[model samples]
Structures are given as structure tokens and as C-alpha cells.
Target: MKTKIIYLLMACILLVSCQNLNRPSGKMTRVERVVSGQTIEIADRSAAVPVLEPIRLIGIQAPDIRQKPWGEEARIELEKLTLGQEVLLEFDVQEKDRFNRLLAYVWFGGKLINEYMVKEGFALAEPDFPNTKYMERLINAQERARLMGLGIWNPDQPMRQTPAQFRRQIGNRE
Candidate 1:
């Protein structure tokens, strides 16, 4: 009886560990809703009843809703790409931003969604600390977009400044 009980306890422990280990790691959950250009509600099973949490794509900057020019276009494009689809979220060092949003590198199917946004000129590389895994890729994508005159990259585009420059300009304006 003692041996049977010990075996049963071991089995239960192994089962619990296995279940925990089976959880998705570094994988983007499905997009439940698109909140804006900078935020999206992702379906996360880790919470009770698969709650939706806003995920902020790290290392890049998409236009803010209140910002000038292609802000709406950026949000539209993001919606078109990932409004109701499953995406893979890759994390670097920091997992969450100051807003308590999940900071991730989003991927849909086999495509890198974050890089695509930059390549399409809807976003720009905006690396923050250790989340620089895709910094080079984002930069290259932005360059390609500029070369191709995509999205906000047109020669006549008024807001063709880099994110850093844009922020500085805004500060100066104030």
C-alpha cells in the first residue's frame, strides 16, 4: 500500500509538471482585437477563460492615432495583417512595457509582422534596451521601404523623419 501511494504521488507530480511545461513559450497568441496602431488585444490562454491582453510590439514604433499623417493608415494596415489571426510572439529580455502591455516581436504564420510593418514604412525601428534582437532587421526594412518609396517613404512625404528625429522635433515644437 505504501509503495502504491508513493507511485501515485510521483505520477501526479509528473503530470502537473508536464502540463506546465506544455504551455506555449515565446509564442504570440491569436489576435482577438486591434486596439490601435500601437496596441492589440491578444487571446492569452494563460489567464482564466482566455482573456485578451494588449500586446505592444517591442523595438519598433508605429504611428500613434493622434499623430499626424499616416497614423490611421498604420492602424489599418496592422488590422489587415493581424486583426483576427494567430501570431507568434518572440521576447528578448524585458517581457512587459511600463504600461503593463506584453512587449513582443510579432510573427504571423512564417512572416515577421514587425519587420513587415517597418518594411512597408508603417513603422520604424525603435529599440528599447535588451529588446534589440530585431533592431537590425527593422532598420533594414525601413531602409528598403525608403528606397522603394513605400507608405510614408514617398519623396514628397512630409513626415519622412526617423522616429528619434521626429520625437526631437516634437520636443522642440513644444
Candidate 2:
């Protein structure tokens, strides 16, 4: 009887932990600024002095600031959606990227901002593993945006290359 009870308890614990692997519930913070389409500065109110931290939106990549009008457009759109708004930051397997930016799925105004950006073609769905909680949704949104020829996906004026590729090309030129 003791052995059976221990096994049952262990199984239940495993199940619960597995369900929370992505850490869906997260810190509620206010956006201090929109740094770019896929990044923002958020106020960490839990700190006594309200420290500002950079948060990189997970599962998507926006045009680099050097990408001409496309980049500026993305930044402006992000600002309109998130600047000064209170947001929920859902974490994933890895908390921060190498750049020390907090990686999160930002929720605001009842929308997943990351996915929305892709859906509207302001960004592209780029899945970074260990943080793919919403990649599928983002990819689907991207497809729809592409089909509709929206924003960056517009056939007549589409962004010439992915942001990562553009960055690499710029680095090579220097």
C-alpha cells in the first residue's frame, strides 16, 4: 500500500509540472517604452525603485532599425499597441537571452502582441526553441498576413530579406 501511494503521488506531481512547463502565468508590468517592434522596456514594479528592463518578444523578429521605412513602421506600430500599456509577460523555458533581455510572450488588450505583429505583417514568425509556447499561432498569423499582402508581406513592396539576413549583410559591409 505504501509503495502504491508513493507512485501515485509522484505521478500526480509530474503531470502538474509538465502542464506548467511554459509558465503561462507571468509578471504583470507596465511598458515604459517601445524599443522596437519585437522589444520593449518594461517597468519592474516588484523592485522598490521600479527598475526598467528590456523585454524581447519571443517567437518573432521585427525589421531592424536600419531596415529603412519598414523598420520605422514596425517600431511605430509597436509603440501604438504597447507604449504605456500594462501587459502580462508569460515566460518560457529560458528566461533571458544572451543579450540579457527577458524573453516573453507579451499580452496586452486581450491580444498576444507578438502574434498580432506577425498577423499584421510587421514582424516575422521566428521560433526560438525553449520558448515556442505560441510559435504555431504566430506562424498561422504570418501565413494569413502573407496571403493578404499586408505590411511587410505586401508583394509590391515586401521587405527584401528577413531581418536576420539583413543584419548579416550589414555586418559584412562594415
Candidate 3:
């Protein structure tokens, strides 16, 4: 009986290992909702909102809604690109943020959303995060956006504090 149990355990391990190997590093999931320019809710089922997980786009930070400069524009741009689309998510060293949102590299049509956002100038590179997998790529994209004067990168616009700085400043005021 002991031998039989050991065999069963081994079989289970092998099965799990094989399953993991078969699954792509970039897991396929559908976007149920766009929370903001930096975060999205993903699910397999067809739901209006999201019953699954909230995936935060890694390596970039979008402006807060209170920023008033480009916050709404960023959110709208993200929604235009991602709502109701199938996205593939690839996680880095860290899994989740302090907010419990899954930190990931979101992909759509073979393009990385994090990089795209930076490239489009809707977001800024978040260097403090441990997930620096695409930091260089994101920085490069941001530079291109800056050069091209896209989105928030336009020099004619008034300078606005980043989401991180806004959060910190708000905290200090309270």
C-alpha cells in the first residue's frame, strides 16, 4: 500500500510538472475591464467588470486621475487599446504589488503594453519597482515618445507631477 501511494504521488508531480511546462510563460487571458492606464482586470469568462484578477502593468506608472493634466486621457487611451481584448500576461520576479494587483507585462498582438504606454507617453518608467525586466525597453520607448512629442510628452503643456509623487505629496498634506 505504501509503495502504491508513493507511485501515485510521483505521478501527480510529473503531471503537474508537465502541465507547467506546456503552459507558455506569457499566459493567455482576456481583459474584462480597464481600471486605469496602469491597471486592468483580466478574466476568462465574459463579464462586464472582472471576476478574475487585477493585473497592474509593470515598469511604468500612469498619472493619477487627480493630476488633471493627462490622467483621463491616459485612461481613455488604455481603454481604447485594451478593453474586451485577449491579452497575454508575463510576470517578472515579483508577482503582486502592495495593492494586491498582479504585476505583469501585458501583451496584445505581440506588443508589450507597458512599453507601448511609455512609447505613447501616457506613462512614465517606474524605476523603484523590483520588476525591472523591461526597464531599459520602457525607458527607450519613453525617450522616443519624448522626442516625438507624444501624449504627455508635449513640451507646450504644463508640467504635472507623476502618480508616485502625487501620492507622496497627498500623503504629506494629510
Cα RMSD to the true fold for all candidates:
10.1, 6.1, 10.0
Off by over 4 Å in 1: 1-25, 160-174
Candidate 2 structure quality by residue, lDDT tens digits, 100-172: 9999999986689999999999999998998887888999999999999999989889999899999999999
Local lDDT at 46 for model 1: 78
Instruction: Give candidate 2's error at residue 98 in angstroms.
Output: 1.0
Ranking by lDDT: 2, 3, 1
Q: Per-residue alpha-carbon lDDT of model 3 for 1-174, expressed as tens digits?
A: 999999999999999999987443677887888888898988735677547778899988898866776888888888988899988899988988899989899888868888999898899877746788778989899899989998888888833677878989998999
Off by over 4 Å in 2: 1-24, 45-49
Counted clashes in each candidate structure: 3, 0, 0
RMSD of 3: 10.0
Regarding TM-score, does 1 or 3 come out ahead? 3
All candidates: TM-score: 0.74, 0.83, 0.77
For model 3 the local lDDT of residue 131 reads: 84
> Model 3 TM-score?
0.77
Residue-by-residue lDDT tens digits, candidate 1, 6-104: 999999999999999744358746788887666778767877788888889877787765457777888888899998897888787898999899888
